[model samples]
Target: MAPQTWLITGSSSGLGTAIAETVLRAGHKVIATARNPIKAAQENPQIEELGGQWLKLDVTSPDTTKTVKDAICQAGGSIDVVVNNAAYSLIGSIEDMTESEIETQFSTNVFGPVRVLKGVLPFMRAQKSGTVVNISSIAGLDGLPSCAMYAGSKFAVEGMSESLSKELKSFGIRVILVEPGLFRTKFFSTFVEPAAGLNQDYIGTPLGDTLQHFKDLDGKQNGDPIKAAQRILEVVTCTGLGVGTEDMLRLPLGPDCFDRFQTKCDALQENLTMMKKIAYSTSY
Candidate 1:
């Protein structure tokens, strides 16, 4: 495969860092962006040492979208792949989460990707070929208790990616939604907790139980970030990773993700079967 230039956001740690390293090792050019480039270099020196460039980018900043586009133009004429991997998890029940908290979550997870896409799409359109990889989660497909805010953000990304895939197909741009189940990354450690003023009545309910369950699953997740990164690279390069064909839109990373997706599909099929006659009669 020919070498391609990849621009990955939130490349300081976790899957982003792993993906950046994987791309560099594969002989591809990587432009890794983080909110604090200095800190990123301090944390992962291998990124610069291994031939990847670093850029300071906070996706929530008003000027960041234009800055990223300009930076890409200055570094290289065009980028072949754009990875929207910058996002953090916000865990809490719907009622427990404040409007501010929910807005901030959407700002980072949903609007951040939108900004990157808006900046990169013009270049991709002009180049006539490009790939967009959006990092989502299994929560996007099936909402879990106490994960309503995070799930809402991911669900938005999934829906947007679906629309973009069709919209940009004629321009030779492909959109890939990566729904990872539970990777052993800094995700749990850095996840945002619920705000103050908790309702005492709901402390021991199912939502509370779910919150505790998430805490217990933090360091015990079965998936590996490095392996997940390798698989993502393989999928983007069309290397036949046993998951699906090259044109597949959604790539679920872990075994847990695959199982959850299958269950969702089965449930959907069952519901459709039960409502087939009513739906058909209404359509006419």
Candidate 2:
């Protein structure tokens, strides 16, 4: 494959930073976007040192589209791949979550990617080739006890990506949903925002237990961000692990994500088999 230009969101740290570094090291041009490029570069000096260009972007803001277009213009009006990786988790039970918190979660996780896509699709459509990689979570496939809003946001991304894969195929645009399990990222530590206060009624329930589990699993997650980033690059470039299998819609990273994905498929299959009669009965 030829050297491609990659535009990645939230490239300050975690998976985004890893992906930017990996892409740059692979001899590709990377336009890494973050809320504060100067601060992000200060923290992760290797990004710019590796020749990754930093662009100021905040996915949650309406200005995201303009920033993306400006970056595209600055990059000679061409963008080959876009990785939508900017998101934060709002962990808490449905009953314990506030309206504001839910809005914030969707604005960042769901709408953020949409905003970026809107800006880049025109150029991609003209080029008739591109890839859109959405960084979702295993929670998107299976709702957990204490991850209502976060799961909801990822679920939206999953649905949108699936539909977009079909919608964009005719235009030579590929959509991939990267469903990752717990990776050793600040996702669990600095990025995971808990609800304002836990509801006393659910403190002794599974929701509380789930919250505790996240705390315990913070730094001990089994997935490696570096390997995950490499796999993503390979998939987008259609090389390495992506060769001979370019039709994959979802790339489940880590053994944990694979196991969970299989479980979800099995459960859905069993339910459909048992409920097919009821489903048909409802059809006119």
Candidate 3:
């Protein structure tokens, strides 16, 4: 594949910034968007210095579609890859989270990317060639304690990406859902806490324990953002670097993600086997 232009969301820091830098290093053009373009550039001058354009974009805002479309036009009128990495972590139990909080979480994690997809689909369809990489999480594959809302949002991404991959295949567009484990990113620093009011009776259960564990592991995650970014780059380029197959639609990054994915698969298989008879009977 020739050098392609990439449009990445939330490129001010963490995996997004790493990805933007990696793409530039690979001699590709990049449009890195953040909520505050000026602050983003001040924080990561290498992005602009590497010939990548930085634009102010709020994925949750209704105006993002036009902003992205205009940016695409400015970037030579085509984007070969679109990486949706703009999302924040919302840590809370389903019962403790308010409707407003849950809606906000979904707005950023699910609807934001959906809007971007709708905004860019016309161009990608016109060109009949492009790749979409949705940044999901291991929690997307398995519902974990204390991360119900976050996981639910990612689950939406996973399902949408699966459907999109099929829908765009005939048009020569591909979709990759990158499920990553805990990485040393600003994600931890910016995690949204549960609502102000807490359930007193549920303070010391597994949910509480899980929340504590996450707090303790804040700055000590084992995954490296730069390496994860490089892997993502390979996947986007179809280069198979650190990937088992170039045609894979789902890429799980980090050892923790690999382990958790295997566990989830095994559990699913076991459940299916145990229910095979009942499932077959239902079909009849």
User: TM-score, each model?
Assistant: 0.95, 0.97, 0.96
Candidate 2 local lDDT, 1-284, one digit each (tens): 57889999999999999999999999999999999999999999998888889999999999999989999999999999999999999987777667887898899999999999999999999999999999999999998888888899999999999999999999999998999998999988874554567877877799888888888898899899999999999988888998865799999999989998899999999999999998889866
Ranking by TM-score: 2, 3, 1
Model 1, span 50-97: residue lDDT tens: 999998899888787798789789977798999999999888767777
Report the number of backbone clashes for model 3: 0
Clash number for every model?
0, 0, 0
Best by lDDT: 2
Candidate 1 yields a Cα-based lDDT of: 0.90
Write out the backbone clash pairs for model 2: none
* C-alpha lDDT of residue 30 in model 1: 95
Over 4 Å off, model 1: 240-244, 281-284
Lowest-scoring 10 consecutive residues by lDDT in candidate 3?
A: 238-247
Predicted structure 2, TM vs. truth: 0.97
Predicted structure 3, TM vs. truth: 0.96
Q: lDDT for model 2, on a 0 to 1 scale?
A: 0.91
Distance from true location, Cα of 84 in model 2, Å: 0.2
